[model samples]
Target: MDMERRTLLGLAAGAGMALSVTGARAQTIADGGRAGPADPTEIIRLWPDGTPGGEGVTVTPIVPERSTDPAFHDRYAQYTTDPILTVFRPERPNGSAMLLIPGGGYRWAVLDKEGYDVARVFAASGTTCFVLRYRLPADGWAAGADAPLQDAQRAIRLIRSRAADYGVDPKKIGVLGASAGGHLAGLASARTDAAYAATDAADALSLRPDLTVLMYPVATMADPYVHAGSRTHLLGETPSPERIAAYSLERMDWRGAAPVFLLHALDDASVPVENSLQLLTTLKAAAVPTEVHLFQEGSHGFGIRLIQGRPAQVWPDLVRAWAARLDFPL
Candidate 1:
């Protein structure tokens, strides 16, 4: 009868389709088909062997709430392939690996423009690239606080576990995120909070990234400046004050954080530049290895697109140079 109900009903219907049901009337029925190994709690197979048999890499559809929420499925349907990673070690290869997290306000992952495109550049620069299709927020289930972080941590550990196979230097793994993904990246680099039980062998590997790259990140949990959507989606309607403190990267100690590179636009509108400024200041004050690039003019969520008159487009090159300075094989 009302907007909320309508939205909920629509979401339910979408969820049904995601679960292989035809319409809104029928309940979800398991096909008893086993999908490949992923986070059994989060990801679902939309097109198990890539999309309709077009193979570049195996891509999976990731849902927010145990892979059952229709609203999340509907939003995820808009994204075809997020291309988790691309390795470009042809000859004289290096062992560095990087995970790229795309930004879409925690609603959807902007996989193509941000994830794959950026990965291509980094891969050219001798770093193995992983374009992540991380779980989105807004449907509870540790959304704002832990879900994305878990995805990143798992990805890092997974890469580390397969380092020899992928020809990656296990100790040189890095993470880069854009917009809300940048927030996730920062949290991944900052928080030592463990999400999964240390049952498996991969659990022994640390999730802390060696280096972090933030492109217009939503860096805080405090009000006014914090992206309310990300906060509400992550913490839910009634998050405790302690949870807020826990998620704020600026408030946390920078000693344990990895080397961080922050790129932001001074004239952006959606997310203020102060987010970068505050985090950079804190990193500097704490003597954390940090680099900040404040572009003259560029809006939020630009996703590697070049502006007509601004030097913001040169970020990839700058980032490549920075990566070169890390002393890993290039």
Candidate 2:
């Protein structure tokens, strides 16, 4: 089954009709509730409110007319819905914060499996977790690569602007993405060659992240090993070879870039293991502090899910440990 949802973009006084599409199966009521780990510090629900009136913070659109495919809800519809982040403020109010980007191949967002679960883990420990419900490329192909990245930057900026209310350390804000989301997370972390332009009050805030967590991330746009879906999304059709190289992780400016934690599985087919390899190499070469972990046998997109006998899904724990090591105040 294919399901599509279209959202109207109201720019100034103009109405822009962008095909905001999603393809995924219908999500059951059970999909809304998470299984493990629950703590209620501060829960904030969001709506489509642009700027004037909304929740404590608003995730404004950086770009208008983003694509949302016809089958967006049918194929991977679960990711399309707006999510209420299960906020976890530290007992003593740690200043560090993280925005979790759940992966769905840019088609769906595994919000519960990756986004909420991971955020809960961090909030329980000592970090504020803001789960990012970013806009995906309408179609599975690279039709809407930049949309997600724009959303990511906007999310960081929003958090930073409201850091005081959220009890988060603006300087300690970090970003985490699973797969395609990981690619966007990396894009937000790295200094891309794409020209930085000011569009709105939101644009005035910096897009750079303080830290990044990439799980099975797509690192390069030019390399064959890099996920083609990711490449197509970032670089549209017939992109010059130079642009392709410029989009690669190795090509970006890593100086003063955020610290990164990368995780991937060796036996994954969706995205090759080499993607993480090249990224870690680039991070290290750039002297950006990073931590690399490669499991022996897990496959792709298995966020917070049990695979082997032990807890292969305990990635949140590792993240908690890593965040503590950063030594940033709450």
lDDT to native, each model: 0.64, 0.62
Q: Candidate 2: where is the Cα deviation over 4 Å?
A: 1-92, 138-144, 192-202, 233-239, 311-314
lDDT of 2 by residue, 1-330 (tens): 011211111221122121222222112121122233332323332222331111233232221211243321111223233433335565656778888887766655665556765666666667878876665544331324555665677677767877898677778888888888888788888864332334556557777888888998877777578677766655665678887887677677787898888888898898998989988777888999998888887788776643536445666667667767887532
lDDT of 2: 0.62
How big is the positional error of residue 44 in model 2, measured in Å on the Cα after superposition? 7.1
- State residue 222's C-alpha deviation in candidate 1, in Å: 1.4
